[model samples]
Target: MPGYGYVSEEQRGVVLLSDDAVIPQVINDRLVTAFASVTITNANVTGQEILPIHTADSQGPRGDESGWIQVVSARATCSEGIQIKIVLPVHFSIKLAPGQTYPVPLNLSIEGDNAPKSMRIHLDLADLGNTKRWTVSTGEYELERREWGSAYKITFLDYDHSVHYAMAFPPEGNCEQWPEKRCPVVLALHGAGVEASSSYWTESYRRQKNAWVLFPTGRTPWGYDWHGPSFWNIESALDALRLRPGVPDDLVNSVGVNRERLIYAGHSNGGQGAWWLLSHYPDRALAGLPAAGYVKIQFYIPYFMRIGDAYADPLLRGILESAISEHDIDLYASNMAGIPILARTGGSDDNVPPVHSRRLIRMVNEWSRKTTAANLSEIPNQGHWFAGVVDDDVMQSFVDTSLQNASTQGLSLPALPSAFSLSTLNPASSGSKGGIRILQLQVPFRLGTIRVHRQNDQWILNTTNVRRFGFVADDRQEGLQRWSVDGTNFDKPPVVSGKSYLKGEDGIWKVADDMLWISEERHFSTYGPAIHIFDQPFIIVIPSTITERTITYRKMAQHLATSWYLFGRGGTQIVRDVDVLDGIAAQYNMLVLGGPEDNMFTKKRQPGLESMVKFLPGGGFQIDKRVYVDQGTGILFLAPSPTRTRMGLFIAGTDADGLLRAAWTVPFRTGLQVPDYIVLGEEYGDPSTGWTAGDGAPFGGAGTKGAGGVLAAGYWSNHWDFDARCGYLK
Candidate 1:
């Protein structure tokens, strides 16, 4: 729109190639005009409006093909280092009023076969819809076949009860049967909201691997219509699985059960339920692998609003438990007994953080004092999903060890960098400060949160309190030590940030440069459990690049500080972006989107709406609710808004406190995962709200905090819009 005046902003359509260098596919969308700009106080040129364009989501699954999303937008630059690229499907329009919405469409792609958490599209935006932040996988890919069933029902033959949508999977290659007996029955239980019968678990594909997997959906509530029981229907499901025509009566007693022996595993939602199966009925499962929910999910249930209310049903829980305790977490402790186990999780995972698995390992080691029969390992470079499932060698080890280890391997944590390790534990003094058991992280990493309590006589930081640990360092750092509380340099060591290369890349590369807060120019010993702390800054080192053809790059390092958030530039009136705020408030919790609607906070129109709301606070994502301040029962917190929009009548609500351990997204490894410079922010924290009675909404003034700043305004798909930026903060 180079002042090529004449064309009034109107509904239109055009198709062109994408901006990212990786995937260049053509996209179609309408053209629109945007008036956006940054104003400075005491300047003669303060009152000016630049371009403001917006977009909308396409129909069903349009603009998706061959690992790339069809996104084409009109881009402009109002300031240097700050450019906007917008790609609108149908939701994007050229006709927008003072308070109309331009829907944001984000389609992320995943590379070839990786784990659940491995390389997927991610919208890295604060006000999620303001930008187009998603994965753009452009890696070496191989055709992968993932056929699984859904909506399976398990019947408890003895009791004549039935669990619908039970799940199972056979080997992908073959389902060759054994000479005698039946396939080992993997009594796989689905997590809350997940009907055990769906192909999400692919029990059929798993069955092809070796064992006969069986999924038993939980029972529906006695009186409630859509409601379901809160625990796993193990007994009933097992009875039903055994009753199958081709299956055997007793699975374990028979060797070479089915095709392969019965091995047990489940991801996030399912992972939580797996604990209950192992706990209440350990004998049924020979081996159990609970990903991220073996401990924390159970511990934080009561505090979680979604599950907290459900605890009222005595039959649904143990007296008073989070109604949704991942269904199986309750019986997890019992499963630790004699059960050969392998637990895996991500260190950077905020939802059902790694602390859950870490705690399980801690409890077992303290009691049995050995990891012989069981072991818990973590993938610090990952988050909630099972990223690089088969690649990281974590799952591969799990498949190998869970089948072999008859005893524990003495659960041992890998040595992390000092940046993540807690150096001291000076507890609140009612008594006095104790000796410091320095949580010495090896090097080149950071820990999530560290809690120092008395581990026997010495002060120690264990996984129970430490929540999670993110591995930032490679295989070169030192370990932890027992330091005195009064020692100097109380902070953990630093981490450098610069471009660095790992297994692949054009010669030397780095994670981040300038973002560093600490330097790795110095050397430190490496060991297990790299310390990760908040507010404590550190650097992320990168692979240094030299000559063009040089593949061997030296390590480059810089530093970055842990971040906190704040916003208060305007009122809450900006909730009208039906495409953005509405969905975000309903799905995320850290921040509340205040507007003139109730449906955003309810589940009438959307089926999984409640599910999103249910899990966000504690389920995993930590998303909260959207409501007016007039509604009571919610707590409140505030943040600073870059956009100085008049604070509309938006009230923050207190969904669940401390329910969100944390939320974050690792920068994409290759430019393939997501477009670079996308506006990314992990909305974490309990949804808290308050009444907004300010005068006119905080106007996006001639201040540094502009109205556009209030909204998550950024270069969407490498483009931007500058409409009357309003109501973004609360």
Candidate 2:
């Protein structure tokens, strides 16, 4: 149910449209800011406030304002003959003859006095101010690998418009170790009810380095987001997994698993989504593996489906009908002819009948011998429940694809050296996304001690040292803060702890071993007066020790060259300064490291960025404060600003509260436009909120060898702060 407004008894004859007022928007799925209050004059007595409530939860206080909210009921108010004005997120414009105060029908229900529960009400612009804003978290997931000493690297691919996804690389790195590089990946899908953001399942899959998995959410035409569908959005999402800042460019393109070396899989709604994506995107995989899913679309009928037939289900049926009522079945059939499909279904599956999948497969194979060759596997005793019998075979085989089928379905990582420990964290990504792990502590190894591992293909930072962590403000960079790891000298022996704990190594999320400190000064300016006072920005620079360094960097250049051609995902134009993952993204395209001045252009990123102008078209790495990069190669687009009507009407011009960017002037919505130049080094504090660094603000990392302050060249940072890490090994 949607959230509506609260009414008070004192204003019986008057309507209160402010303060926690839940004015529902008229447009489907469109949200409106909530209002604070609305007053009505010449009203009756009785001053009482009523809030949103649910009559089904329990009794006595049925009409009490204690409950959260129930947006469906228009007659929820207490008074029977009271008149009130309700504000809506949508404004109704009337076009009468000329000068007329046309009475608009408002959906305010009062038993008999014209207080209709559902009417389109006429409202003024001033009656709005109560938009509900809730907190949403896109929690982080740790990458995993089974092998030791492996530079953790993994590529991810997701498709939601056609299928739901949630995948991760093994806990280990995917890059070339002293002996090897280039890791394998897995295709993971989600079930019904949960989105890709859910850590419960994603973490489970994130613990493997041998394979990488992909995750995506479903979308509905009538709903605000997605329900399930694949290829439609999968292409772009896969592109993002490869294009995200900080990944090794060379390794990014390698993530698109060898078509012949992949396994297709899914669960529940995603189960059907998987089948659809496989049938739709012929080049997506080598084998099909869906659990708790139907054998065909026929099984999706309500009487048998667990979620019931979405086509028959009130909510999804409407969505399904509206979304594909005009689509052609041949489109899906033609796409399925080239690939080998392996359908895994539960005999008793209810959400999706085993029969639906069975029928769909039969239908596809009916007309073509090549398509009919596809295989279908069913679990004997399994049903609609999520647990299945093939997790090991499917996952393990995906990891060992090269070894198992080295010829037709093999993908090998660069040869890696045997397990080895780092000499120091300074040169490794252990301290940041761009570097590697730190040195291993000597002696006094603690038992049951904990270690923290990073997400994606990052190394672990050893925290066994006696060093204490703290955040320090650069008297130089006014608001920026950087973490320092100190206390135990290189000569001190390691301390002892209770149990062995691995933050990213053992599991997706492990407990923190030691206390972490952060100072209020997190965001810093590049050339700000605050940092200037400290003499200069003093950041601990890590060594460039990535394997296949030149090869990797070159690959990065290539990835950048063709990034725009890559389909899927949102935003375009390169404009953020970030770390270069030598072997990863560098392998896919050429990456250019523009100077640090990219962080200051919060309003207009396109101005004065000569490097972006040169690098974008040249297909090289360019960095700046702009939101997107690689428009020349792929669709990493910077989403456009919100519609003008939704602009914040604040007295101050710099309110810059809109999500994504602070710029009020937006490029009118146009077809996906690609630019020949690049700029995107200045990273936003949060993508949802367009927080950027001030002009001339430093990137806040290690500067060139001799440069004293933070502004020196060679120092790098995507955002405003530095991350200090502590962890345990063995």
Candidate 3:
């Protein structure tokens, strides 16, 4: 009724029951049909009313557009285990572009007889776009679109609580129906702007006889370029198959994905993501195939265009760039020494030239003790895309061999080499090798390395810039293991619970009595650069009382929610202080908006933060002895969660105007770092604002286009304390 009209004969703007419906002019004679369907399975004890919701995109209508899309809604009924389709709610309008996605309510009342418990039903309709963006297909195999709710809120373009992933069943058969044995899975990542539904993404791959390929939407077509939230999406999708978190147990009962035989493969941006994930999560995959992958951001496109770096302080730049150092895939290449890799590229291509794969191959060879672990395949006289990029004889052979090897190894880690090296910049993102993990680094954002070798019946270990490390002994290995770490000798018995941890103190390594899991010091999950707060499920906590100040705070929260949807395909949950209980506060890392006076949550926690940051009674705040009473000054910082092991990101200002200025510093993209904390002033302009390409630069350069700049910024100490050396004051 909202977007359509009927021929008017008896009245000017009234339609009779016998009149035919007319389509809108904009859509204009397109072959339209209901192309998308969302199946809703009732798993409850009794039939209840269900209101299905749809997610709206952030790219709202433009110009004179009404900013709403018309969609037809229907009800799904089940009669004695048989599904019956019924059309209802002829047409309705839902808002699309609101910076962030909100649930568009659909009317459908289910009765017990029609929708009994354990019944499966679906609502189908034609979307604004006719194509199903999340569907994947391979002519030879059966591919289906599956959705599962994320453990954390994504706050992406759609209010739909579910994240969609494309699954291509093995050539043998659909694993869901006949999963007598586990099938190896290839986690394929799509390039930037490449739709998950595209046949080119999967059809070009040489399919294994019994392997399945998984394609994640990465939240959106270009979501995070398979980093940050995009990376987490892959994890969630895999978990859904294995019946882990964020999925229903009945979704996939049989063991489908072979946990030990997983492979990572991609092309273009996905190729780069494959390399990143392989290095960061080496233990997850048996092999990697990255075609047309480029090197890190700085190497991909040199920062010769960055205007600010010429005169900026070296310390500031280092702190800022530290946030993105993980993007440099080469830095963590050593972690993949034991894993096999097949790197490919087009020799004649200009986009992501051949040198990238060549360099990556060379680096892996240089770091690997087994020189044959990595190989390069260069296609001559070809550009970026070619038929045999990943479907050729060599590629097929590699896949077959990798799967064969995985079958022999089962799900256990391949026999570890007596001597090997583990390199990392961020311990949180990087994976462990051979039961050895780097828990904490002496200096954050700096290269940390550990080299281990066995000599003369004793295990010798050397570490660089490592503060704490641990080793979990394997049950297969017997007897007491003698260790010499940095010349400090110790004997550890490889018992049932053989976990040994050590910490470096004043150049000497000592057995640390404190458990690594409960350590208060900045560890893997708690590290930060402001942007890391979104890596987990976080809540936006705003002031409960309605006021001019609270309204401004709410606006800031809305901006953040929208930004996440646009850049990271993330979902955010915004709540008032009064609605957040103690259990909720302890469970989630909060993004607390407004100062103590306006936000009750902040007021209750201010005393604990007084030593480092204290909000004044009337207006303004103080950081260590420096006082800022200006209405144009804003403060942003990450503090340890007062109630739990999580982190809390505080965004507050002297007043509403300052809060707006501070919101600019919260990064939604790859580049533009705002370390642990920063003080912003509306003077020189907002630091690094504008389009942030996946490359480390903003719009091809260090952007400074918004209305303010960083007044003071720095990292928190290893223990989350204010350290003078890590801070910068104006």
Off by more than 4 A, model 1: 1-163, 171-180, 203-208, 220-232, 245-262, 294-298, 302-335, 387-393, 400-730
How many steric clashes does model 2 contain?
207
Minimum summed lDDT over a 10-residue window in model 3 is located at 19-28
Tell me, by TM-score, which candidate is best.
3
Q: Candidates' TM-scores?
A: 0.30, 0.31, 0.74
Tens digit of per-residue lDDT, candidate 2, span 1-730: 1332333222222233232111222111111111211111212212222212221222122232221211111222322333543332212121111011111222321222232222222222111113221211111111122222222222222221111122234324443321133333355566655645455655544344444465644321111112112333444345544432123335444333332234556666556555655543333344455555543332244323322232122432222222221122223443344344556677766566677667656755652344455556676666765443335465445435433443232342211111111122111101111112222222111111113332233223344431222112211122212211222122221222321222243223232355221111111111111111111111111112222222222222223212211211211112112222222121111112211222111113233223222223322322333222322111111211111010010000111121112111111111111111111222222222222222332554421111011010111121121111111000
Tell me the number of clashing residue pairs for each predicted model: 183, 207, 10
Model 1: per-residue Cα lDDT over 659-687, one tens digit each: 11111111111011111011111122111
Cα lDDT of model 3 by residue, 1-730, tens digit: 2333322122211112111111111011111111112322111112121111222222222222221222234344433553434343212233222233422222223332233322222322222322211111111111122233211211111122323444343333323332345666787788888976566775676555656667777766787767777777777666544432222345344336654447899888889999998888776677899999987877776764665555456676666677778668888877777778999898897889999998888888887765566999998898888888866898888887886676565544455456778888777677666557787777766788999886645678899988878765442233436877888877764222334455546677876654544446777778877877877767778776666664466457657766765675444556667666667665677888888888888888888777557889876888777888875678888887765367889888776657876776676776566778888664524323422222332432433422124566777767776767667666
Q: Kindly give the stretch of ten consecutive residues in candidate 2 with the minimal lDDT sum.
A: 644-653
lDDT of 3: 0.60
* Candidate that beats the other on lDDT, 1 or 3, i.e. the better one: 3
